[model samples]
Target: MQKLSNLIGLPVLETVTGTQIGMVEEVLLDIDQAVICGVLIDSENWFFKAYGIGFEDLFSIGRDAIMVRGSEVIKDLADLSALSSIYRLQDLTSKQIFTETGFLLGILMDVVFDVITGEIRAYQVSDSIITDLLYGRQTMPLPQAQVIGPDKVIVPDTMAKLLHAEQIL
Candidate 1:
């Protein structure tokens, strides 16, 4: 799967019409599903904006292109503003994880998403086996997984407790 950051600057192309719509400014987060919801775009045609095209008409697009089953392209420019208000993946990385017993686990390092559903599948810890193989022992994996906000990812209390006890190993 591609990292959310990779899509940040990639041009959003309309596969159906082969039109270059715009570049992705930010990815909207679906808090309910703990996954990416859509891409926010910047459609500032200088002349159009000068003639009073609103910002809302320039910034939002649907996730249809990212969906494997969808064929529809986002055509409405008015809905673009809604994307700016949605939570982003960057927001989730800032939250802390705590166990039911109130132990502090590590921060969220990454989110694993299912390609088919575009839903979050698991939490990847920085110090876990994968991270150890990639980075080294100064890191330890923490257990906590939940969505706190559009950008806030929280670790579940139950998992936090298990991790606190070192039972995850």
Candidate 2:
């Protein structure tokens, strides 16, 4: 498991030529399916106008870098923003989260996801002042989280009762 935010900025190295291509700029997530499609690398070769590798093509992901088989497989689908569910963790960072009933929860701090399966496991949320003074930070179960839009996320109000401040620290 790894935090989605951490994947950004990791170097992408081509295995065949050993060329350091670029750093991961964003995470392409199929949010409706809750799976990671791939990563968007802002490549050094602007002329090529294309550089993205699917998760299946990734040789390995480590603390240092991500290894891909070769450059041949990297596609040039430049405008992935058109894809409705193309969720970039960086785009959602610090966004406000609330309950379906319009109760503000807090800001979205982080996401814990499976590196192997690309499934999001939990959301580490910073609580709003009223709740923060009571529970501090809370890790909401994935089932409770509902992304209402780009600006806010909603979790059921009852979701807060499932855990106390002691569990999160």
Among the numbered candidates, top lDDT falls to: 2
| Candidate 2 collision pairs | none
> Model 1 misses residue 73 by how many Å?
3.2
Q: Count clashing pairs, candidate 1.
A: 6
Residue 163 Cα positional deviation in candidate 2, in Å, after optimal superposition? 5.6
Instruction: State residue 156's C-alpha deviation in candidate 2, in Å.
Output: 2.6
Error (Å) of candidate 2 at residue 115 is 0.9
Which candidate leads in TM-score?
2
CA lDDT of 45 in candidate 2? 72
**In model 2, what lDDT does residue 144 have?**
38
lDDT of 2 by residue, 10-98 (tens): 99998889988888988776667777778888875776453577777788888789898887767765676458777777766787877
